[model samples]
Target chain A: MASSDILLSVRDLRIAFHGVEAVRGVSFDVRPREVLALVGESGAGKSLTARALLGMAPRGATVNGEIRLDGSPDLAAARGRRISLVPQDALSALSPVHPVGDQLAAAVRSVHRVSRREARARAVAALDRVGIPDAARRARAHPHEYSGGMRQRAVIAMATLNEPDLVVADEPTTALDAERREQVLRVLSEQREAVGAALLLVTHDLDVVRDHADRVLVMYAGRTSELGPTHTVLGQPRAPYTAGLLASLPQDGPRRRRLPTLPGTPPAPGELPPGCAFAPRCPLATDHCRSEEPETRELDGRLVACHHPDRIPDDTATLFEEEQPA
Target chain B: MTHLLDVRDLVVHYGTVTAVDGVSLTLEPGETLALDGPSGCGKSTTALAVLQLRRPDAGEVRFEGVELTSLTERELRPLRPRMQPVFQDPYGSLNPRHRIRDAVAEPLKVQGRWTEADGPTRVAELLDRVGLAPSYGARRPHELSGGQCQRAGIARALASDPRLLVLDEPVSALDPSVRAGVLNLLADLQDDLGLGYLFICHDRAVVRHFADRVVEMRDGRLVT
Candidate 1:
């Protein structure tokens, strides 16, 4: 793809906390109005990677990389106007003191030179657009008064109120159950589409990635494990870690006594193994894998960071056994 | 044999609002019975009533052929240890100030089952059984990962040697990889100990995979 075709480009993004690198040399791009999912377990640096895009890395953290917005490289000036965030905690994104609608109107007035009445009307319409029933009345209520699902929707509305080119949502639906999760995700996707914004969605839910994301970037430890189209990557995974994660998922099928789990936990930052960060737990790890860190290489129409991508078994379900006595 | 747990006409009310209405269920030993539903649908309320943590407004909770609703506080004291609850938020469920070892040993010490000679050994055994390392017992709840903290919570529940475990969204708060490990541990524990599980979960995939039978709840009533 051409450089101009990308909405946002990140090159060798590195985030470090007190000299210990957590997100090490990760790189990817957000295409124009596309949903790119950043997926991994806790401590995998997916959240930090997303935060770095908005120049919102944690206090005292050192971030070094190239984050360019349409070849401009000025994220701070373009944060709310061109790239907005829908954080995991909806309450934190909203003010408990102000009515939800007023907060959204304030967000609008900050970016655009609009009258208060016009902004308030736009706020209520935005709320209504996200399926918040009685948007006018509910907009007058504080965020604490809104139900959990409604509070989440209000945040979604607030994020897209400015109609940014990119929306970075970090685990927006993690706290919700099945029904509420679907509702919130639908509203988020719909609002993003209505605003014509690409999404940098950071979540641990593979089902959400499969259903919503156009492309997926699977991170392990702090590096890219795989990056490809959602169906191709999830259906025929080229990375061992990705396959192990998929195999562990409980599907709607005949129940099994045990799930195929990765043997060890993800290594803590600054404590990674000699070669691959996932080598200790990877079933396909060989001596070569243990000695040399594999760079991101193109294979099977996707990017996989593994020396033996083709050696991944056809049936990844049997990759790792629990090794228990019956 | 009597059913391990039998709840009949269970009703819980928060002031004027009825949370769980006329819910009935039965679980046999070594079986997992899931109460599946959306949020605010009274799944946790029913579990609390079964555990007698929240006395139902009206119901009959018969555990091991004994009607618990008729029991007084003193009468219910002994039965409390037999039915334990594993909550959703692993860190919130455990004390932040207490060491993981102390948390696990609390139930043993409370029930007058602890001895100076074997208490520490028993704590070590419980931690090992739940896939936690011995060194982890020295740390507080915040120091451990979510999955490890949940295992610590499970070890604490197992310290009571309960006949029934009221697992309320035990794995939902965990990551998928970690959730699978916890679920596997629960399955192994139930099989080896012949314990019954009153599993309350909102994830349908997890309910279908983990439970022997599932009852769907909506508006405080069973849909099926």
Candidate 2:
């Protein structure tokens, strides 16, 4: 892909807290009109990395990296106008005291210095675009008035009001169920199509990512495990951790017995041992894995970091299949 | 075969909202029944009525051939040990300040089954049975990880030795790697103890794997 087509690019991005690194040397790119998913469990440093991209890192975090947006050298200055955030928890993400219209209007004015009347009109149009019924009347209601799904739509509307080039959504559909999950994902995909914006989706739900994300980035213990197209990575995972995550989902086999699980817990900050962070729990870990950290290597249109990679036998259909008979 | 628990035409409401409307179900001994539905769909509300925690507005809850909806709290005490609940949030359901041993033994103490001679040993055994070290009983809930806290919750639920367990989204809050272990533990407990499970969840994938029979709910009513 051309450099101009890439909306956001990061090189050697690292976040440290009091001498301990939380996000270690992460690097990637998000192209225009593409959905790039960053998948990981708790303490995987996905959220921290996303927050740092928008100049909203956790308190006392030390971020060191080269983050460039298209032609702009300064990313922090063009945060709202060029890049925006769609937070995980929609209920508390929007302000409680003010009307949603005002919040949306404020977001619009943050990027473009439009008049209040024009901003309000644009806010209503944005809310209507996100499929909220009676956008004009609903915009007048407070955050508490809307349902869970409605609140998420309002958040999305505000984030995309200015048509930013890049939208960093951290677990956007986590709070919704299967039915609402589909609705929110449709809104997001449609919004992406309407406004030619790149999406950086950070989430733990592998099932959602398999269907929605165009590309996938697997993270483990603050390090990049695997990066490839969604189908390639899920069908034939090149990293051990990625395979473990895929295997953890209930497969479409003959029986729904015990699931294959990774043995140990995710390492916390400062708790990582010598060598690869995932070596403690990986089934294929060897002596070399325990002593030397692996580097990302390009292979088969993907980047993988591991001593031994795996390709599932029989080419499974998909992860999280609806039902398997007993 | 006689069912250990039965509910007929169960209807529950919260200020005319109708959280659960006309739900009927039964659980046979050693059987696993999963309830699948979205939020605000009355899966949780229906499960609550099964335990008689929320007395139904218009329905019948019979446990071991006795109706619970019509019984007083005092009259229901003797039959309470037959049904137990394992909540969703491990941190909130348990007392943070109290040790794991005390939390696991509280149910036994309530039923006047606590004996200094066997209480400690039974608590350790329960912890071990749930794949936790016996020494973990000395730690508080906050001191343990999400997986450990959930195991402690299971230990406490199993302390009552109930024939039926009502688990509400037991593993939703846990991480994926940790999720399978907990689910496996639940499966093992069900097999070993001949326990009946009323598994309530929003994810049908988990329900299909963990439960023997599936019940679907939507808009406060069961669908087909």
Candidate 3:
């Protein structure tokens, strides 16, 4: 991808608190109108990385490295105008006091010099676009009156009201159930396409990443594990951690007595191992893997950070075949 | 023989709204019966009714040939330990201020079964069975990871020596990697103890994989 094609460029970005790094040297590019997913287990710093894009890293945390948006490093000024954030909790993102439409109108007026009537009109239209039924009348009610799914749609409408170049959704559908999760994702994608904005989706659900993401950036202990096109990476993972994660997922085929679990837990931030952070849990870990940190390099048509990417089999199921119940 | 859990015509109403209407289910001993549904479908409500935490408006919840809905709170007290609940949010299930050791031992203590000599040993055993190390018992809920905290919650549930476990979205809040470990632990425990599981979850994939038989619920009623 050319520099001109890149909507957002993050290079060697690091986020830390009290001198302990949590997001360490991660790099990625979000192309125009593309869905780039950041996937990992808890404490992977995927959320922190997503937050850093909008300059919303928690207070007292230090962020270092380059975060250029269309050749400009001024993310602070670009917030809400060029970039928007749809947080995990829709209820928290919206205010309980104001009417749903009023809050969205306020958001519209926050960046643009539109009149109150125009802002309100755009808010209702935005609500309609996200498939909130009876959006006109429903907009007059408080957020407390709307259902959970409706509140989520209202939050998405609020995020895209300004028609930003990029929208960062951090676990947007995690709180919802299976049916609602798919519905919200559908509405989000529809709204994104309508606005012509790229999406930075941060989620731990691999199935969601598989279905929606154009490209995936797998993170582990605040470092990139694998980065590539969704099908290519998920179908044939080049990294051991990615393979283990994909294999562990409950497939839609015949039911098995046991799932292929990756043994042990992800190491917590600040308690990371010396070398490759995933070495402790990875089945392919070697003495070299334990001693030397693997740099993110192109391998098998994708970026993988592992010493033995070649050792990982195309069929991840083989790694756990012995553990499979006969 | 009577079923391990026999819930018939279960009806739970919140004011005018019916939360669970005429929901019926049965589970044999050592069987896994899943109640699969979307949110607000009364899965949790049914579980609560089964455990007698929330009294159903109309129903017969027979556990081991005993109808629990008609039982007095005092009468139900002794049978409470025989059936336990493992909830969705692991962190919320365990008390934040209590140590894992104390949390697990509380059940024994509450039922007047705790002894100074054997209580600590029993708690440690429970923790070990749940794949938690002995040292983890010293930590509070916040200090442990989500998966470990959930294990502590399971160990606490096990301390009661329950025959039936009501698992409501047990692994839904956990990451995929951690969820598999917990599911494996549940399977192993069921195999060893022959415990009946009333598994309530919204994830269809997990339900299909884990449950021997699954009943779908929608709008407070069972669907085909």
DockQ of 3: 0.79
Q: Which CAPRI level is candidate 1? A: medium
Per-residue C-alpha lDDT of model 3 across residues B103-206, encoded as one tens digit per residue: 99999999999999999999999999999999999999999888899999999999999999999999999999889889988998998999999999888889
The DockQ for candidate 1, computed on C-alphas, is 0.76
Candidate 2 iRMSD, 1 decimal: 1.3
TM-score, candidate number 1 = 0.98
- Cα shift from native, residue A306, model 3 (Å): 0.6
Evaluating just chain A, the predictions reach TM-scores of: 0.98, 0.93, 0.97
- Report the alpha-carbon TM-score of model 2 versus the true structure: 0.94
Q: Name the runs in model 3 displaced over 4 angstroms.
A: A321-326
Q: Candidate 2 lDDT (Cα, whole model)?
A: 0.86
Residue-level lDDT tens digits of model 2 in A51-96: 9989999899999988888856598777877788889899899999
CA lDDT for candidate 3: 0.92
Score residue B163 of candidate 3 by CA lDDT: 95
- Report the lDDT of model 2 for residue A187: 94
For all the models shown, what interface RMSD does each have?
1.1, 1.3, 0.9
- Rank candidates, DockQ, best first: 3, 1, 2
Give candidate 1's root-mean-square deviation (CA, Å). Answer: 1.2
lDDT of 2 at A161: 83
Q: Which candidate, 1 or 2, has the higher lDDT?
A: 1
